[model samples]
Target: MLAPVDDVVAWGESLDHLLECKTGQLVFENFLRTEYSEENLLFWLASEDYKKITSESEMKAVAKRIYAEFVEVDAPRQINIDCVTRGEISKNLSQPGPNCFDRAQRLIYGLMENDCYPRFLKSDIYQALLEQQ
Candidate 1:
């Protein structure tokens, strides 16, 4: 659902609030693209999706895909993360658990919260959305 004016205003109050709203995520994704940091947001989104998997085979396939796309060395859309976190994820990719990407997700979420969310609130894109409301 699209966020109302009040919900848009609330997006400024916390990154969690913004992420929880689909419209907010789209706007934020747009903002992140402009900043050339969309990879982090993509990884974060994928991790959230990974948590909802039910089929074991599907989960394993997704785990491999996520690893190849965002976690592996020289991944096409690699997210910025410490070696320790990357190493841990790499080691666990074989097992493919639901929470396997938790650490990397947290790191990316924190990066967005501290570095991107503030800018998003102040951005013209976001401001225009608020203006329209």
Candidate 2:
């Protein structure tokens, strides 16, 4: 079973605030197209249609729907961030991707390379932070 994402859940508003920033918009876009799952919000929020994902493929299929909505509504440019929590992380990790961990790892690295957190100390810390992504 997955643990709760309440911390990250609580962080959603903060995340939304972060996403509202210019850079955040780009990050949200990249997140929409990449490995992140919109179903995280759906599952946690538990809307009528969201309760239907029962399998890995089902999750990904639903995720595509969420992804479409996300692209149109969340991010208009090409940036994204990992707003998922451990539980949501577990759900996505449960499904198959082209090396989900590795992909997210590299995604973080790429984001850093592109200077996502321009004020951050350095790119090395970004790679170290990839373990969380």
lDDT of 1 by residue, 12-116 (tens): 889988888888889899899999999998999999999999998999999999999999889999999999999998888778899999999999988998899
Assess each prediction's global lDDT (C-alpha) against the native.
0.90, 0.38
lDDT score at residue 54, model 1, on the 0-100 scale: 92
lDDT of 2 at 111: 56
Model 2 vs. true fold: TM: 0.24
Each model's TM-score, in the order given?
0.94, 0.24
Model 2, total clashes: 6
For model 2, the local distance difference test gives: 0.38
Give the lDDT of residue 14 in candidate 1. Answer: 93
